[model samples]
Target: MSTGYDYSWFILTQSIIKKEFALSGSEQNPDLTGKSWRMTLRRATNKGAPAPVEAFKSHGVDFIVRDRIEDLVAEMNKLAGNDLLKLEHIRMQIEARDREIVNPYVKDAQVMNIHNARRYIGDRLIRTAAPHRILDPAQGPLIAVKLNILTRKTLGGFETDLDSRVFGGEGSIIPGLYAVGEAAGFGGGGVHGYRSLEGTFLGGCLFSGRNAGRAAAKAVG
Candidate 1:
């Protein structure tokens, strides 16, 4: 989802139309068969990753390391249990993206964005990595991580007022019931609308909790 392309990692999604993996079973007993994403990064890039090198190796089934692109592709395909990705296609894409890194005034949107982000002191020092060719032998020992899509949070919940009181079926306040934070739909059900901004949920949660606590204290007093 992040398109900043800071050259930290190369993300590739499986062809949705070309494949139809199983998705049967209940939420608690759900099946996760044949679902994976290919995320490749060079040795230098991996060093900058939040997790340490040992963590990736310990990640069983989801982690892969290879010194060569050809071998990397082969392992990736073997992991997927099918020939979903072609070595040539993957090589060409990486090569094209790498070519844009050499040009300071490159027209590539992703590369340009990465450059722009690196302009910030904080990003340059920690978050963003300097542009580099992903396939460069100097940055050898390519790493591939098989990622899975999972829901971490919900953006929708019960409609509530400023005081965090839940609304009844007829839109009136329901006494003795207060839904705050995410339960009250993240900032009283209207602050974020349909799509909420990332990293802003904590503020919403605190605000809603403060209001709910204050209102509850007043009601009891």
Candidate 2:
């Protein structure tokens, strides 16, 4: 839902979601819920977003599918029952973002982040898409979604270390106890440091969970 305007939302192409869209809940992601790594990997490398995302595009109330930006904006404005969005304004912003794809070292922070993500073996294999222009016809027909808030995870909480041991105000590890997952602030009380990004929460939780289990096991042994 980021298009550089507080009042405006983003219009993602079919290509964008394939790498980024991951629906939460058991019913939403069968592979994930079933704990099948093979199926989950296949889903990631699949031609499009998971089944649930496609279902949303086809049936969700907030979604609008269109081949042209003009038509997409028109439908979006109509859905909101307001003229607050302008075609020219939206086009200008999209064009600007698309322009960043050409740079080897892009100035656009989001685009740069996309490139950064692709550098990781796991992310490159399935998580992030290669840098490409948003308006590129090959990646379209455009998909505009009227996004609604769905809380997937919390931001920050109790601080901990690599072993998931809670830290006291005096910066010492509190003994005989451990924290992990969301309880460890999704890893060391905000793994992203000063600036957190989307999709990092689960990874933090998994990492801390392992550390906590290992530490607690050794402590008892």
Candidate 3:
């Protein structure tokens, strides 16, 4: 949204890939093209992400809503000067979503400023704590983060032209042409700008596949 947050991952990885592989960044900065990271592939392409510090705002993302759910009720009841109970719950929610997807600011202790913990673990939710934030077994269940983490991955390994190619120009290929998902190459690989979708490779496949299918049918007929 804003801008100024400098992303090191994109800058570092790209540098390594090119310095070692002799590969090009897009086509323009074929030289320092190594300065971008796979993660920034989206923002670098998006009309938004101008800089990092400015783009990285608050922590807005999807997470588990924790009210209280435990797999072991009995285990939760057995702890008392003894190691018996082990029940837990985890969930939290936030107002920002889109911003979190691209640039998520990981909080410390992960406990937000509201005394409540927010999680972006695949889904959003309120991970509640014990009364007065005691974190006691008797007070309530302890909400924790799920194993699966939710994050926005960048697009790369392929190159897409944005100049004469037009935005999403390859969206629909002509008959006889076939596209192989990411197999194509750097998407929106231009000197100045690019556009990219999250994980909708099927769109590209369908467009190219359809063209091939039609071409095959005509040849057979």
Per lDDT, the best of the predicted structures is 2
lDDT of each: 0.63, 0.78, 0.30
Those runs of model 1 whose alpha carbons end farther than 4 Å from true positions after fitting are: 1-61, 187-189, 192-195
Off by over 4 Å in 3: 1-177, 185-196, 219-221
Off by over 4 Å in 2: 1-8, 35-38, 149-221
Per-residue alpha-carbon lDDT of model 3 for 1-221, expressed as tens digits?
13432211110112111111221124333223556554334433332222331122112121121234443233223322244323331211221321332233535333343233224321122122111332223322222221223333334433323211212446643433333334443232221125554334446545544554565666668
lDDT by residue for model 1 over 1-221, one digit each (tens)? 37432222233211110011112222211111222122222222334232233444446576666768888889887877778778999899888888998887799888899889889875664446567777776654566666665655667788888788899999999998998887877742257655676666778888888989999999999
Question: Alpha-carbon error at 221 in model 3, in Å?
Answer: 4.8
TM-score, predicted candidate 2 vs. hidden true structure: 0.62
TM-score of each: 0.65, 0.62, 0.24
lDDT of 2 by residue, 14-122 (tens): 8887777767555778776789898788865666677788888899888898989999999999988888889999999889878778777677787778888888988
